[model samples]
Each structure stands twice: as structure tokens, then as C-alpha cells.
Target: MPANNPPDQPPTPGQEPDRTIAYRQHNDQPYPQGYPQQGAYQQQGQPGYPQQGAGGYQQDGYQQQNYGQQVQPGYQQQGYGQQQNYGQQAYGQQAGYQAGHQQPGYPQQNYGQQPSWQQGSDFLGTGQPTAPPAKKGRKGWLFAVIAALVVALVGGGGAFAVNLLSGGGTQPHDVLPGDALGYVRLDLDPAANQKLALFSIAQKFTVTKSSFTGDDPRKALFDLLKKDGAGLDKVDYAADIEPWLGQRVGLAVLSPAKTGGEPGFVLAVQVTDETKAKAGIDKLMDGDKYGIAFRDDYALLTANQDQADQAVKAAPLSQNTNFSDDLNALGETGVLSFWVDAGRVASFAPELAAQNSEALAQIKNVRVAGALRFDGDYVELAGVTRGAQNLDMGQPEASKIGALPASTAAAVSFSGLGDIIGKQWAQILKSADQSGAGVQQFATQAEQTYGLKLPDDLTTLLGKNLTLALDSNGLDGDQPKFGARITTDPAKAQEVVGKIEKFLAASGTAAPQLAKVPGDGTFVLASSQEYAAELAKDGGLGDDESFKLAIPDADNATFAAYVDLDKLEKFYLQNLQGEDKANAQVLRAVGISGTQSGPDASFSLRLLFN
Candidate 1:
């Protein structure tokens, strides 16, 4: 060990003394003025400290040495500027950490320079700075890509707009007779989105998916018709039907024939190729009692050749303003749509006219339009009917069922019921009797026994708005919690309730308790007083998410009904097993709502999915 070495150190046997300590001892002077303190290294070119070299930690003070290599007392190592040998290896020949020429295809990197990352080059290998490669032809390629995208978007958008304006494709009205009294059309090919939505929703349920076995719904339906024995036992769908069958099909009830028999009907089938369709029809009608006639793209089928020829000569239903207006008012047509001229149909059916002559007389003319639509979450059947003359249908009213408790599992409400009962009591009795139920006899006996008027008392009890609600709270018991609340004149409601209670007591029937709700002209007939009290409270059923989802327009509906299957499924499904239970589980709720505006009435019925 050398005596000049610091504590806890053993000097190399053949190495020179520590130069940093020896230099400071020899100078024996404080750091020069304007320079850093003793412990800090001086700036480059400052006296008493050596300038740093490219690869050396300190220049002209002590030479840089390889680890574990002994330094001779007077030996001086060269700086990076002058390459030299390290032991037997030359500086330029050392593989890594050497300040010299590099491997082929790589730039030379000086030792202790900034790393490659900061120099904008590959970091893992050399620390040399690299020039960025030119981005040749990128702008032109980018413009080409952008131009293609714009063209595709514009073309697709134009096609979509045209499809929407043209109503997707040809409709049944394009072929059926303009003067048809009744028409039912089925569109096996709906819009792409509608078809995809139907297919996606159908696939969620096993039973529905079975009916849609193929991507082409029309072919699936034709196959089903063949298998179901629809008088197509001898017809092969692939050979006879698929060759020319277009997507739209319609059945129309035409005017009575000139010979004055039953109303004639024609089935119009759209054809893609007239020649193929004619040949296919000849095969289908080989031994059948049917006749066919071709007009434009449609093949009309009738009972005989005369009827089919007459149908082709008439103006197409697409030109009928009444039919078009009615269907347009009903909004977008769905997979299945129908139109009915009520007066014309009634005039043809003498039996129906005779049975309801009074009711028919009120409406001079009526047109009905309806559609069956499918969505991802629900299936809806919607219809609209407009009458030339105002019928007994009443105005819409805000429903009180919204105030029912949130736990209500099922409810039905009606507005303008009192007026309906008052005006239609006689007709209702007649219809009831026609059904062979003896309702007139029962009503007469009830009036005599209770000493009450036929419909006047009944109307007073029913009132303007009536709602019936049932909850699952007590459904497990023998007597479920259920109640009916009616909006009526309080005094009249009380009198009618008293008369009804007395009538029930005299007849040896269990009587329900009836009472007027506080602060409102509403009366409740309930199985228990507690349920009646619940009916009176201003509850939040209207704000409940499930209620809103089920009955969206309940508040302003003339008539509405809702059932919460999610809440009641446990009780009803207790006895079910296997596929029935699984199918039932898919149903979440059901809702029906109807609105009337003057002579027009519209209604929707929806089945919601889980």
C-alpha cells in the first residue's frame, strides 16, 4: 500500500499515486478568484484544472485506463483524438465503448457524446446523430386516399337518399287495382337496416330464429309454405316460385263482378321476369281451379280468367289518393301493411251491415291503415282510422293511472267511458244478445232487482275516466290486492256506490268497499281499505323507468293498458318448465295505447323484450 493513498484504500502495486490529491498538495493554494469552490471541477481552460477531452474524463491530469489494467508510473494514455492500443487491443479494434470507426453501414460515434435518442437516431446501438429520411410520395398517396373516401361517401349518401325518397323499391299498391275495397300486402324484402334488425332480433329467440332459417326471408317463407301444406304439396318452391318471385305480394278485394255475385278478389304477385313467371304459373295451375293474367311486372291470380283480365285493365292502387294519403299518415310502411275502405267493405257484407246498422249509420265513410313493425327491443302493431263523419270516439285526456304506486304490476285505463256507455248502451245490449249471452235479460233483471235505471246509473258509476290496477304485493295470497278508481262527480259516485253495495248484499254476493278519495272527485272500489288508500295517494308510478318504458304515451292517451311482466313473471311462471319458461322470460312488458283526434283515431300495441 502506498503511504499517499487515502484511508480504507490499497493502491495498485505498480500504479502511480492519486494525481488529484498530489496536484492539490503541490499547489497548496485556494481556488483561483471567480472560479468554483474546491470540491467542484473548474470550467474548461480555467487554471489548476485540466480541460476535458472528447473521450477522457479529465485531460492532461490522469490518463483514462481500462478496468483492472495496471498503469506504469510514467505511462500516459492518449485522448480520443489520438487512438492508441489498450493492452494488446487497439482502440479502433475494440467492439463497444470505443471512440473510433464503427461497423459497416453505421455512423461513427464518439464516446461520452449525447445518446442516440436525443440525437434522433436508433437508441439501442450507436449514440451518433442521424439525418431523417425523406418522406417521398406521401402527400400524393394521402390525397389519393382522401379522394377515394370522399367519392365513396358522396356516392353512398346519394344512393341512400334516393332509396329513401323512392320508398326502397316497388310497393304492392303499384300492382293492385285502384278501386280495391280491402288490401293486405306483405313485403318480404324490407329495407336493409330493417331486414338486419329483424334478423338480429329474431336470432335472440330460439322459436323465432327457426322461422328465419336463411338469409333470404322470402325463400324461408316459401319453404315454410311448402312444408305447412298450404295447398302447395305438388309445388317445389325452388323450381316453381323462386325463379321470378319478387319481394312484394298483395291480396285485394275488388268490386262486385258485372254479373252481380260475390266481390271478386285478385292476388297480385310481383315478378322479376315475366317469361319465367308465366311458365311457373302454368305449372302451378296445371290441375288447379285458378286463372292467371300478366300486367307489367305483376302476375295476377284470380278464381277465373275473366276476373284476372278485369283486374289487369283497372288503374293500379298506387294512383288512389285516399289509400295513399291514409297510408302516408300512418308513417313508414312495415313488413306487413293493410288498408280497408270501411264503407265499401260494409256495403259488400250485408250480414255485417244488418248486425250493426245503427253503428254503421254514424260513420259516412271510414278508411283504416295499419302496419306490423319490428325493432331491436320491441315489436309494434300500429293502426290509424279516419272517419268522414265524427263517430262516438272521444277526446284524449290525461290519465290518473300515472298516480298509482310504482309496484303496480298491471293496469288498464279508459277516458270518455261514461259517454260511450251512455250513447252505446242499447247497441251494446243488442250485440251482447246477438252473441247469445242473454245479457239483455240479465240487465233487465238487475234493474228490476236493484231498482236502478239501465244505463244512467251504470254511466254515473263508470264516470269520465276509469282505471284498474293490480299489484304483486298480495298476489301470493288467495285474495290479491287490486282496485278500480273512477273519476266522477263525488255525489253521484257515492249514490251509485251505495245502490251497488245494497244490490250486492241482497243478492248474497260479497260486496267490495267503495269510498271517495280525499281532495279529488275520484272514487275507488277495492278489495281492501288499505289498497283503496294506496290508490288515493299521489304515487310516482308515472316516473318509474319500467312504467315509462312500457307505456310511453299513457299520460295523454284516450285508452291505455300496461303489464309489467318482469314483476309478475315469478308468480305465473312458477308452474312452467323447459322451453315455455325460457320463451316467457324473453318478454319484459306489454303496452297498448290509443289516441283520438276528431274523426281520426290511432293506436299502438307493443311487446317489449328483456
Candidate 2:
């Protein structure tokens, strides 16, 4: 609990005592006392007001002295029959104490002398009705009002403190968050062409988040406010959510806590704001709304493939299976799939599955493939492509008016200009290529293994010597042998297969030996991927380099992940250390599958460390 400051003045009677809640909480299970029990005190039927005080009960015009009256200005006395048990005989005996008084008519007292005490139309002949006593006058009334206000403040404030300490809970009768204080705090991560640029923002933000209610809503509200941005080592949300403090929302209140001395309510609510959310993601990727511009291959691919309605993706089975599933390489669209606990993911209603229809449309064919465990009520999706090779671009590289360099092409939008990168985009020409360059990358190498060749020239690129496994026999198969075709240096592989060709070249040789894990059947690479992969092999990547390289900063949440490797082996030993990292530092050493092509994928870097 936070420390307390002293009150400006001493507490009054019946006020909530300081620190009462904390003390009471120490004995949380003590029985509650003094609830307004059901049917405690109510008029049995119609209300009635008989003549004066008890003994003076007038019975149809009979009057007498103050006979047997309990004399008093401020005291009450009990009667006989009330104390006696009622048997027929006991009832008769009790009746005898009543003193059946026959009142002889006595004239009422004359009020001329003490006229001030006498009730009159004209008070004390002052021509005005008698006013309240001076002690109960305006000054007295002022004192009363001030006293009342103080009581109320103490009650309200103290109750608020108590409620906070007790977990300001909603009661069965309170309005829900969507109904009371309404707003939302949306987070966004836009799509980069490939790889994802991590992003988040702290700009002022707002949404109609509501809450449920029951007890003292003020106390409940105060309690909730205290927790609004209370996070440690996480991005602070205070500046972003403080502004939407007073808005009222409409929603249902679900569960509330039991009521006692505290006051307040808890409310769960839904919120919405598409634009701010998108911008916040921009913050995470960059600082300002539009602070930086870059590319994200993972984002573009996922969005594109999903829009295209492709559904080949998969996520990890669980944490126990995380590394293996990642290396499995089942993702077809170049999508990198992994597991996130669906049961733990929580968010507001405004950020519903229905919000990103247009973005979702971009990847019409995209699918979130995974064992049922990794999926939630819903998950955003995106596509991926390993290199330009197995992609689905419809035109030839020189289709555009002018040529573009690889780094230069990264900046230019192909949407406005056609694929003029010429040989620059030869990889795109090959995915659905009828010349079967895609299949040839594998078969030609195979034919070479049998002592044949004379096809296209393949060389000229730098790449990291990293991959999960080697085999074209689909997901489940033994590692293929290079059989003595190539060397083991990854840098060597990248330097050789960097160029593209339209005419015949090459020869044949025995397959090279395949590399495998120390003990497991897990593989490093084989003769085929060495000959077939199109992405440059030497442009080394840092372990934490931005995978997205074709768009401005953004938060692209959607993905159609693919894991290429031996499901069993990749699940255990392989690792994909990001760019600029040693092959020895693989993210996870495991077996994997190979994609004719890979898809674009995104991930929240924060959770990775977690």
C-alpha cells in the first residue's frame, strides 16, 4: 500500500478510521455484521399516526389528567403487558394494570399567558409562523451542513482508499467499463516488406473504454485509475491513456465483488480507434507518427499471400516444442511461424478480428497453418517468401521502363513502376516459370549428381551459411547427400550462386558429404539447396537485423508461418541466429523442411525476450 498523508483535521464520529481497511484485511475471513437483513422493519400494512404520546392515546373523545403517563422530556419507559407472556389467564391479569380510566371532560389549558409555547397561526403574535430555535437557526444549519459535508468527504475518500486496497471490484449492480468510463489504448505494428521492424508508441491516445459498477463508483474509478499505467520495464502507458479520463461508455457489467465498508466497482470494457492504433505501431517501429521509413519483407509477403488466399503456414505446438516447430519449415508463403499462447493473449473489443479487412484482403490467400493449439479465437496473419526465386510475380524482370539495383530497388515501389529491374528480378520470373527453372534448380543438380548438366549459369551472391535441413522429399525424409559436390563454407556457397543465366553452362561431379548435428540426424544443408537457392549467400545478417527490408516502419501482426525442416529434428536442435550472427549461434539447432519459396512473417520482439 502507498503511504498515507495526514488529514487536515481530526476525524469525526462514525467516520471511516484511517488504515481500517488494511487492518481489516489482515483478518479477511472474519464474519460480517449488520447487513440490512431482509424484511427487518416495515409497516405491516397502511401507515397510522394516533393522537399523541402513548398513554395519551385518545379513544373517541375522552380526556383526563396526565394519568399514568410516563413523564419525560427525553426519555421512554416500557409498559406492563409487553413484558408478560400471553396465556388467557396471564392476559387477563395483564389487563388489570391498564387502569381502565374513565376520563371526565377537562377543559384544555388556556394559552394566553404562555402564548409563545401555544401553537398559533400567527407565531407569538409576531404575524409569522414560529421559526426553529436559535440553536437550530441558519447559523446552526450552516454548522450542520459543514459537518455533513465533512462526513461525506471522509466516507467517500476513506471508502475509496479501502476499495483500492481491496481490489476495487465491481458489484452485481454496477455498470460495465464499456458502460461507465469508456476508452481504449490500441497498439500497432505496420508491415515492412520482409522481416518485421519492431514498433510501439507513447503519444497521447484515447478510446472509449468502459467499466462495470456496483458500490461507490468513485472509489472503484479511483482504484482503476491507479492501475491504468502501472507497469514495470514495460512501455509506460500513462501519457497515452491519461486524457480519456471522463468519458462515459455503454456496456454490460459482468462480475463484481462482495460489498462491505469499501466503495468502488470494476468494469471490463471494449474500445476502438483504428487510426491511432496504426499510428502507435508506427511508434514502435519508429519514434514519430512518420519518423522513419524502411522495408519489411515479412509484412508485405504475409499481407500479399493472405490477400491471395494462400493458406500454407504452421506455428509451434507449444513451448516444449517451440524450437523444433520453428525449424520444421512448413510455412509455404515464406511465412515464419512460431507459437504464442492463445490462452494468454488479451485485448480490447475495438481491436476485434474484423478491424483490418483491407489489410487482410491484401493477402486473400493467406492462411494461419498450425496445430490447433497455437491459434486463438482469432490471429492476424501475413505471408513470406524466402528469396525472390519461388515467388509468384507474373512479369519478367525487365518489364519496367528502367533498371534498378538491389539496394535501389528496395526503395522504389514496384506498384507505380513495373518490374524494370531486368535481370534484377529474375527470381520473380522463376517461381511460376514454365521454363521450370524452379524445378530445374533441384533436378539439374540431381542430374549433375548422375554426371550431366549444360543448363543455366548459377553464381554471384553473398549469403549467411544458415539453414535448418536439406531434402526435397517434403517434410518427412532423410537428409540428401551433397556426395562431394561442394565445399562446407557458407560464404563460399553465397559467392558462387550469386549470378543468373539464360543459357547453358556447367558440368557434373559426385555429390558432396552433407553436414549433420553432432549426434542427431538434423542437417545443415545439402547439395540441392546449394545449387538451387537464389538469395545471395554472403550479405551476412545480424542476429537482430530488421528482417523487413522493403517498406516503412509498421506493425504487421498477421502471418502465415512456415517452418522448413524435419518436424522431429527441427523441433529440437536447429537454430536461426539473426543476421550478423555466427552460424554456431543458431536461434535453435533443429531439423527443418525446405520451401520451394519462403513467405513473409512478423514477430513482437518484446515477447521474444520474455
Candidate 3:
């Protein structure tokens, strides 16, 4: 169909002009041709070479020569097969060599298989063919190593994200503070907090939900820092020395011995950036006696240089045995921690000690430590008080303490209230006399009011383990119904209830319904006989899993209490309207529990909210 014919006059060998094949990407575009296209050639009957096409040889019968290969003698001249079917059988014949005769490592030629000429397949070489040049093994191995490194980097980054999301590791306690009557530490950046404080205060006038898109608490802080703590109206706190003007800072109340004269305090900051922190302090001091002292990266400031030096030289709070023990008991990583040396505080503040001498004397040997942690929907604060031998804060007992009924809204349990009451009876009587309750002569008053002879000593009716509870669970119709329950020795409880009944009869009022748990040693103070009877049938809180979770380790607890804030919040909200109701904040529950070892006591309060 297509025209193809030889030229009428073939050029003589020496007079032939050189020619080139040109390639154009589009019909309209012309590009100069590059290299001269050479024809392919193959020898017939060569052991590993392809066969000649159907044309066999040219009319002149001269042996064909390969474009770049040396030609062997006795081969017939041949034209190349169609290039579009390059890998197909040449002119209808298969390659000359049989499949089994392939070189030891050479790939077998298949139907339509392209010739790998660039792989240096030298057909002229001693009857052997070369295998594809060994792939760049070193380059492949290098790429594999790089791929592994990329995977490791990606995995490490993911791990870091997980750690940050899970609340990254806690640093060691701020050990810059020295021994003092009181010491406080916070796991926060003081500089950041100062910025946050300024931002929050300014937000009242300058910030609004629609205008501010960023929620990071530090954005405003950074802006405030740039402003040089200015623009705060009416005595800006940031303008003054933010004592906690560093990454970590603490306050310590040093005794007179360490303070040089007056009982003074020092603010110690862990200086992350010395230049910035120092500038802040300089602006605050303004030539006052309080100056900054640097110990390495830590900066201390106090009323005088001596106090600052004392804070630097004295033993750190981290090394204090009692304080560290208490800190561990509360949670080492809590947001805030504080310790109070009761003896030191009393000695430092003698004026207050003189006013409350008796009460102070009782707790003079106490060492108090507390910690605060803020979890989602929960704020927990725990305190530990380690007292000296003389304080006689009772020890735990093996027997179970009073267990309040499940319907209770709030309850308090204490170990041996009787012993403490007896020890402080005189102070108790004095306080009652001052209050007009006349408890100093309670026996006489009881006899006159109830027409019954009361025990001369009030301790006779008391029990070692006591529990008192209030029930407002039945609150409705804006009027809260209140019920009270007390647990102690069954015999002692009966005696006290009888005395109260007699007093009610003498007053000519309806006697309050009283019911007792059959074998649980608890008395229910109910609004009616029917309610009291109903209360006796329910299980106690001690058997409830939710109650146990609220107050854990009850066996060793010296005192424990649980408050159902949900019920309390509902009761209060029911009586409120409009803004009052909208602004009301409620917690899920609050559990306060304590443990006493010898004279030392530790207490924790767990507050849960919605």
C-alpha cells in the first residue's frame, strides 16, 4: 500500500553524500537531525545471534556488517526487520540459536524480547554472552540505609508526640529553696505564669470570643512580655517584681538565725534566662534592700543580702527527710507542693504563739506538707502532718471504723475522738463558756433541761471510733429534708439516744424518730419513724465500691469523710434562679481521708467534678 522503490541512479561509492535522519515532535516544528542512524546486522548460524530476515541477502550478495561490531567473513548481507516489531521474530523466523544453547548466565530469549544491547551483550566475544551489568549494588545498599534512617526518624517523632500528649515526664523537685519554716514549690514557669496573669487580666476588657481565635494561654503572655509589662492600669502586678520571674521559682520563710534579724522570706528562681530574669528583678527592686543573688543559674532575692545568702548556703528542701517523705506520699509530680515546720513557724512568730500558747504547744512538733494536682474534672489537694511524740495524734486500730449508710450525703469517721476530747476537755470547756453554750457545766444544764441526771463526766457516753453523717438525698420542692446519723459503740449509742429522747419529751415536742442498724452499731437520725425504719434495711457505704474508691485504704485511715457534692449542688441550684443558677459550680464528690503514724499524720482530699 505504501510506496517504496529504489533510486533510479545509485550513487557511486566515493561520490555518495552523507545524510542524516531528522525527528520532529510536531508537524509544524522542525528540529535539526542529530546522529546518523545505522542499520542493525546479524551473522547467520552464529551460536548466540539472531537469524537473517526473509530478504536473506542483498542483490550484490556482499556480507552484511554490523553498525558498530566487527563483521565476520562468509555472512550474507541482510536488512533489518521492521523496527515497530523490534522484539518480534525477524521476518517470520526465530533467532538462529536454540533456547538450550544460551550462555551459562545469559537470560533466555523469549518471544518479543527486546535485545539488551546496552548491557554489553558482545556476540563477537569467544562464543559467550555477558550477563546484564551487575546492578549498582553499593548504590542500592546506600538507598536501603537511607530508607531505614527515615523510618527511624519518623517513629521517634511519633513517640515524642505520644509522650507530650501523655503529659511529658516530670522534672526533679525544685531544690533551690533552703531550709526554712515554710517552703512552697510549683511545677510551672513563673515567667510564663506572669504573662498568663497579665493576659487574663487584660482579657476582661480587650479579649472576646469572636475577636480572639488562638486559645494558647501563652500567646497573650508573650505579647505582654514584649510590652515590657506596661499598659496595665491601676497598679499592674506585672510591672512590679513577679517574684516568680523564672522557669521555676519557690518562696521560703527563713528563721531569724538565717535571716540575720527579722524572720524574713526569700524568693528563689531557677533562672532559665539570666539576662531577662535579672532585668525583671532590677525593675522591681528599684534600689531596695532586697537584691538578687545568683548561685549558678539560680537567683535568690530577699529583704536583705544575708537572707538571700542563707537561702543559697542552707540545705535544700529536697534533702529534708520529713518533707520528702510527705511529698512522696502526696504525689511527687503534683503541680504545687508546700511544707510547714510547725516548731519553726511558732518560734519565728512568737507573738501569735503567745496568744494561742496551749493550742500551739499541742502541734508545736508538727511538720505539714501538702500537694495540689489538677486533672480533668478533678482538683486534688493532699496534706501530711508529721507531729512529734508528745502530740499524741492517735494510731490506727485493727477493727473496722464506723461505716455510714449508702443514702448518706456526707460522713466523717475518726479514730478515738474520745481520747482527744478528754485530753482537750479543759480547752473545750473554756471555748464553750466563751460561746454562751455553757458546756463547762453541761451536766448541770442537762439535768435541769431534760429532768434526767447526766453523767458527771461527758466522756462516759463517748466511743473510741466515731462516725457522723448527714443525709440530704431526699431534697425536693425547694425545701431540703435533712437527716443525721452517728455510729459508735452500740451500747454507748443507745445511752446517748435515750438521754436525747428524755430531753425531747421534757420539751413537750414530738420526739425525733431514732432507728439503729441491727448489728452494724450505727444510729439513724431520721425525719420520721418510717424513714428511719427504711434506712435500717439498706447496705452501708463500706460495702459499696464507689464509696471505697472515694476513701481508699480505710483500714489504716485515722479519719475519713466523703461528701456527695452532686446532691448538694442540685439542692442549691434548685433554690437559685437566673444568673445565680447559671453561675453555680458543682463537683462530683469530695473525699477527705487521713493516716496517722505515731504522732505524724497525712491527709488527702480528692475533689471530682463534672
RMSD in Å for all candidates: 30.4, 31.3, 30.7
Tell me the lDDT of candidate 2: 0.22
lDDT of 1 by residue, 192-214 (tens): 33332343354344344333111
Each candidate's TM vs. the true structure?
0.67, 0.17, 0.57
- Candidate 1's C-alpha runs over 4 A off are 1-167, 208-234, 258-260, 289-291, 352-356, 388-390, 426-449, 513-518
Candidate 3, residues 1-610, lDDT tens digits: the string is 0000011222234321111001112322221121111223434444544443222211233334344224445333232221211343222322222222343333433233221111122221112223432222322343233222222211122121111112111122333554667887654421111212222222121111011221222233434554785543332344444433443456777677632356667777666566767776665455556756776567877777776666667666566666666555554234456778887677556665655676677777778878654332344577777766565546544223334456677777776566667666667776678669976476677877764443322443344555555665556554333444444455656666687787777778797455454337655555655555545544476765545656767767877888776667865666755433432342367787877767777776776643
Write candidate 2's Cα lDDT for 532-567 as tens digits: 331223122112122122111222222111221222
Residue 477 lDDT, candidate 3, scale 0-100: 53
List the lowest-lDDT window of 10 residues for candidate 3: 1-10
RMSD of 2: 31.3
lDDT of each: 0.61, 0.22, 0.47
**Steric clash count of candidate 2:** 152
Tell me model 3's lDDT, rounded to 2 decimals: 0.47
Worst 10 residues of 1 by lDDT: 113-122
Q: Give the TM-score of candidate 2.
A: 0.17
* CA displacement after TM-score superposition, residue 606 of candidate 3 (Å): 2.0
